[model samples]
Target chain A: MDYLTIIQILDSSLRLATPLLLTCLAGLFSERAGVVDIGLEGKLLAAAFLSGAAAAVTGSIWIGLLAGVAGSLAFSMLHGLASITFKGDQLISGVALNFLAAGLTVVIGQSWFQLGGRTPSLSGDGRFEAWNLPFADAMSKIPVIGPAYDELISGHTTLTYLALLAVPLSWWVLYRSRFGLRLRAVGENPSAVDTAGISVVKLRYAALVIAGVLCGLAGTYLASLAAGFVKDMSAGRGYIALAALIFAKWRPWYALWATLLFGLLEAIGNRYQSIALGDFVIPVQFMQALPYILTVIILAGFVGKAIPPRASGQSYVKER
Target chain B: MNKMPKWADAVLIPLISILLAFFFSGLVIWAIGKDPVVAIKTMVQGAFGSTSGISYTLYYATNFIFTGLAVAVAYHARLFNIGGEGQAMLGGLGVTLVCLAVPWPHWTLALPAAMIGGALFGAAWAFIPAWLQAKRGSHIVITTIMFNYIGAALLGYLLTKVLKVPGSMLTESARFPEGAHLPNFSEILAPFGINFSPNAPANMAFFVALLCTFLFWILIWKTRLGYEIRAYGQSETAAKYAGINPSRIVIIAMLISGGLAGLMAINNVMGEAERLIDNAVEGAGFIGIAVALMGRNHPIGILLAALLFGFLYQGGAELSFWESIPRELVVVIQALVIMFTGALDNMVRMPLEKLFVALGKNKKKEA
Candidate 1:
């Protein structure tokens, strides 16, 4: 690829990867703690709409971001209650949450905006604008990789940096912290964790709550950070995030690579459409389909066994 | 849905769930700024409101029965086949392709081709996920969901680029040849004073659905293969020990799921649209899961559940004729039924069985 095009791809990659990385890592937190999060998509969609509307009304991106997080937290708590407490079927409950979110958010969008869920677009001031690292423009003058590095990697929304930071943070929290160890313990065997004096259910709930907060950030990134909310702007990214979490084998750091790969795949399709490569393109459907195909191939044994945390789908019925 | 005694428990539990769902539905009508009593009256009027409405409800219920059976088949095998939407769409797609491409010298040849095409198309869709699950041990849930998207995207690409007919973004395949269109017999029925309108898409599919449900019931309750599937569903490891191949059962279940849902092609494509539409499935495949679940994955029960969905759909459609509630309110009602029914089904299945057995014993003594 040309230097300018290479730069463009990297820039686009980061932009696309931001949401997947943030949310997949979010998924890791919950699943690794043994709480199944089938409702991540619903949570993401709900957050995106709420934040998009909030940003347009308040004209403050930060407030919008908070709104997204708060909304997602509430959504996650629903997941927590259904799967974590009631011991309902995790997959079924998750599916219900998704159906609920898709309908309820549209209902809200309809009542508030009256535009069939096409929320008001945020102003430039209300968006998290692209930020160039200091001296990065000058660095573009360097050799073969220079242009590629500059255009694709240099300028991006503030969410990209936060998504990057989130990877390490997820790793640190999942592997290094005491709660992380306890959380992992809970996921592996809740009974053991409970026997050890830990409130296995509570810790898992906390993990889900944290995951919910992260999903809020991911949704806000799509709605307020990357662009404005345009109906199903989040689309199936929440589910994609779920796939990414699996592809990464639930490891927090590997989630970065998995998310980035998906982003790159998405960016390739995006670029193909823009470049008028229709004839050469393997149908946009196929391109749009790459992630799921890759996920199936990966999950279907290519990436090796991905044994979920032992207690992943189990409900911890507390002692009477 | 737990298997309980063969009588009153099964009946009472579903009735209770239905009653609860209807009550909640009345509340929804109230929230939407309509009098609950009037809304119920209106819904009843619109659904069975007239002879035509009854015909429409019958037409609607027929599709639900197929979709519900699709879901029930998988549940029997202990698999969650969530790719119903895609499979149903593919069924229509296949049937449409055959109807358009086949230069049938006569109607007899053309109709069968369409039917076979639809079934094979749906079978292929189900096979993809089933094969993946069997060989890879991947959860059917994940692969099926992903396939649902792929199927939708495939249809979208095909429709817009290749299959684009003369229309707006709503267009799909070319219109079917006259030989391929199913006969609308409302005119004939009218002479008997028991008319089902010619305008009504409802036809033999209702009978087909009942036959299929009965077929499924027989397959599950009587056949050795059915017994194997049930065995696997009950305990895969134990079934394996009993010499059943788990993979085979899983693949069979999924194939059955897709094929049953494929019958949608009769109603949705060849029966109704005469060609593909942008959203031919209208989320019927996914809703099938809720239907299957609420029906407790039993054939007779699924038929009942399908009737309820049919009522909501026909009633909801008629509402726009006189009311302001969106057609989507029906989906809301459907979702709530599954939700509330799901909880009660779990709680009531046990006690109802005991009651049914006691009643059966008393009846047997009287006999």
Candidate 2:
């Protein structure tokens, strides 16, 4: 109802959406090339855990960020090789990567961090601080919209900005660039690309590596910027990103809106832990289940018989 | 041009699969500064070293066999019923409810009734997604995963609020009645003075699981329904051409899968636990995926694979008893197994393909 409260709500939503934005965009690239990036969750969790651990040790957030990105990229490439080169199922590869991340992170963390799951809390300068956008704070005091801007924009870590920036960047790469054009062509019709004398395998492989790097950054944001890694910290966000990707009709801008919508619900869920509606109230569990329910509804309405890239899951055998 | 031979395919594939899984997991282990050999060895011993451990492992395996079969049954129909988690959880609830309702007669009527109740409940839960996929053109995989979340949250709410047992902060229900206890073969063994070991439960569910495996195998191979299921899995259009209604088969497959998942509750609630609720299936439902895949969706293979999983389950817990290793190492091993099983077919194909070819040629020569 109040301006300050509205600002607070937007602030929380952005903090939460950072991981979604990063992972969702990360997925956008892999999927743009027609590789279903189910492993995004694994990448996020791995990056988050490794980044947090690296930051804790080196006492530098930059090192943590790099390590996180590198880890995710490496893992994503593994997925690419398995699904793209070996002709394995993309979904299976992604699920394996997630299991690998989930299992490895916990095992290593319990052994190294010694906090069970709680990694040593990073101190001043060990974390990404909220950016102070000039003149924003002053405007935040004015009215309802002013506070909303402050909550949503003024306090985000640098990564949150990167997440927003990624939408247009992804759109440009997918729709405008030659690489994007070729990548889309390969995903749709690798044989045609091959006939055209372009190396379909190499192009798709490159696309996957890029996807890995993006996912890595997303993980770093979650681990270092949002909250440090918890057990299965990526939770089901990777899958949520997949849902977002599908609902986005595989478009970057649409993905942003879809992801934000999901983020909005999550933010609302956190805020309205238990809504006391006069006589009786629904518990948070029902509300927590709302996103998945909404996802089913969204998929039902929009994704029915939607066109996937032509060569999405097909393995190309070299012409003899 | 000629295809590769069979003998090499059979032997080479599983060998490569094992090696890759081990090497890959070893790299992971080494990266974390742990000795891969020790961790793995500890995992194996932890799961299967002693007698009591084997019994407990079998108990766990019995639960997995049913759930894994549930998954495999659906897989045979080319459906990914990830709602095994929800179905099993609901089955647990059903069994608990039945135990609450059925007055404790002898184990004869009580045990079967509990199982039937669970099977029906799980089957009903599964019907929703099956119907959606069959009639509405929805993807069963996505729908099932969604339903899993619904089941988790729904069960949490139900046990915590609407059906909260008398006094417990933990999300669990009240214990079952005294006579509602499952018929314990462990007790039978004790009375006969013919113990497999003092520690192992070695209950009737193990036999039930074996019987189910044989029955499923027969159904898959010898029955018309099973033939249709396999035919549909192979090619839906072809099956339809052959007069098989894909929609009907899809619904039946899911219903059967859910019923099997419900059987998982039979072991835990009727045999193992006095009562069960929220934490009923643990991650057996998910693990069932690994089990079904490892089993190659075959009933006999499922039995063996489930036992292997059971070993992993118990061994993980048993590792704590060992002085040097952490018990949690079992999870690492299980995770490794899943990763291997998922990627293994490619590795295993080369050798197994060779062996199959050789066997085919030998049979031809004899003919």
Candidate 3:
């Protein structure tokens, strides 16, 4: 209600939205390239675990980040190998990867650390501390505008800014580049792309790689921001990101808006476990269930239609 | 007619995939400095060594059979109903309401009423997703998955806030009345001089699961509705031309699937826990997808797959206790089985098909 409260809410929303934005963009790339990746949850969990573990072992956040991306990339490649090379069902492959990640993280974590399927609590250089933007202190000295900038826009982890920048970058690559053209072509009509002398497999693999990296960053942010990794730490955020992707209708810019909206909803849910509306109390579980319920509403065509890529979820077999 | 044999497709391929998955699971165990052989031995002994062990295994298998059939029925109609978890949760609520609202005079009377309640609740949960997929062009996978989480939250709310027994510390309902409890296997088989583990949760619900499996077979193969479902699944355009309504079939298939999934609560709630406890469905709903996949969406195959998973679950718990292996490793193995038998079938099939072709050629040359 108050301006300070509004700024605080906005701050928390940005913090929460960063991971969703990264993952939504990740899904955008994969789906746009004709791959339906429901394994985003698995990739996030794997990356988060690897990053947190690497950081704990090596005591360097940079190594942790690299390890996380590499781990996630391994899963992305596995998906590609199954869905593309073997001509397997893409959805099933993704589901398998999710199960693999969910199981292996704990199995390996317990074997190594004996910490009940959790890595050591990250501290010192292992965690990503908030960084103040240049002149944030100076900006805070000014009037209303300065305080807003200082409080709402400054002092986030490095990955948060990267997530924001990824949106425009993803938009440009998807709409303005030559590879983007081929990628879009592959999703809509792989035969046409093949006829144009492009390798559909290569294009899809590239898209999956991009998706892997973005998801890796998302996971890294989750672990580093939270200061440690817990079992199933990604929880259902990856699926939530998937819902956000559908809510955005496979667009990059819309992904930002959708994720932020979900993030705002999440922030509200966190802030208010229960709310009094007249004489009735709306429980927090309903708030937690809002995004999923909203997604079902969207998919039910109450708001608008969500038409996927024409060739999405179809395995392309080359004809002689 | 001039192709490979049926046994190779149905039996050999899955056998090879299971072998491959086991091979990888062994490697993972070895990587962790544990004995793979010992792990395997422990799992086997823990799952089937004693009467008690077998009873637990059967108990877990019963849960899988219900959920697996749920998935298989929907899969025949080309629908991927992944919300069995949520549907089962709603089914638990249904069973709870039935047991608590009315005082049944006998278990036999309560059983049928609970079945109706569970099936209806489960069907209601799945109806919206099926409708959306049928008419609005929404993806069934995403909707069903979202519903699973929503169901969990809803069940949690009900158990904690509305259904909690007065002054009870745990987030669960009071135990069901004595008359409402399903008879366990030991009690049921006592007249036949067949002794089952008295303490095991394996109950009359297992027989109900078997009955459902038989009914599924009849509905899918022996009935007119089954013919329509398979016909619609094979080719929607052909079915449409033949006056079959695709939307109607989709809705019908999902309702049946949801009902079957919901029926699993009989085993978990009324049979085992005797109370609507939180997370009683556990991951049985998700495991049902893997079972349906490995079983190739056939009732018989689902039964076999469910038994296999039940072994892993009961065995894995034993391994975790005796050998310090993480219980989640069971999930890894299950996922691998799914990956190979369901998604990566071509990896094994291609080589085997080539072998069969080569063998046929040699036989022709000799002739």
- The number of the candidate with the highest DockQ is 3
Estimate, for each residue in B1-367, the C-alpha lDDT of model 1 and write its tens digit.
Answer: 5345545455666677677767876676676566767766777898886777887888788888888999888888888888888899899888888888965566567766776787788878999789878878888888888888888888888898888865565657887887776655484476678756568777655676788889999999999999998999999899999999988999988888898888778877887788788888887887787788788899878988889888888888866456755555675567556655552354455566666667877889999
Candidate 1: clashing pairs of residues: A7-A148, A7-A151, A7-A152, A10-A152, A11-A152, B9-B352, B45-B49
In model 3, the runs with Cα more than 4 Å from the true position are none
The window of 10 residues in a row where model 1 chain B has the poorest summed lDDT is B341-350
Candidate 3 CAPRI classification by DockQ: high
> Cα lDDT for residue B88, model 2?
91
Q: Sort by TM-score, best first: what order?
A: 3, 2, 1
In TM-score terms, candidate 2 sits at: 0.92
Across residues A1-320, which tens digit of lDDT does each residue of candidate 2 receive?
Answer: 66566667767777777788778887777766767777888888888888888888888888888888889888887887677766676766776777778777776787788676556777666688788788787887777667666667687788888888988998898899998999888878788889999998788888888878878888877777544667777878887777777677678898888788778778878998878889899798887787778767665654454345666656677788
Q: Which stretches of candidate 2 lie over 4 Å from their true place?
A: A277-280, A302-307, A318-320, B1-12, B26-45, B195-202, B320-328, B347-367
What's the iRMSD of model 3?
A: 0.7
Residue A225, candidate 1: C-alpha displacement in angstroms: 4.7
Candidate 1: lDDT over CA atoms?
Answer: 0.79
Give the winner by lDDT: 1 or 3.
Answer: 3
Model 3 chain A lowest lDDT segment of ten:
A1-10
lDDT of residue B302 for candidate 1: 90
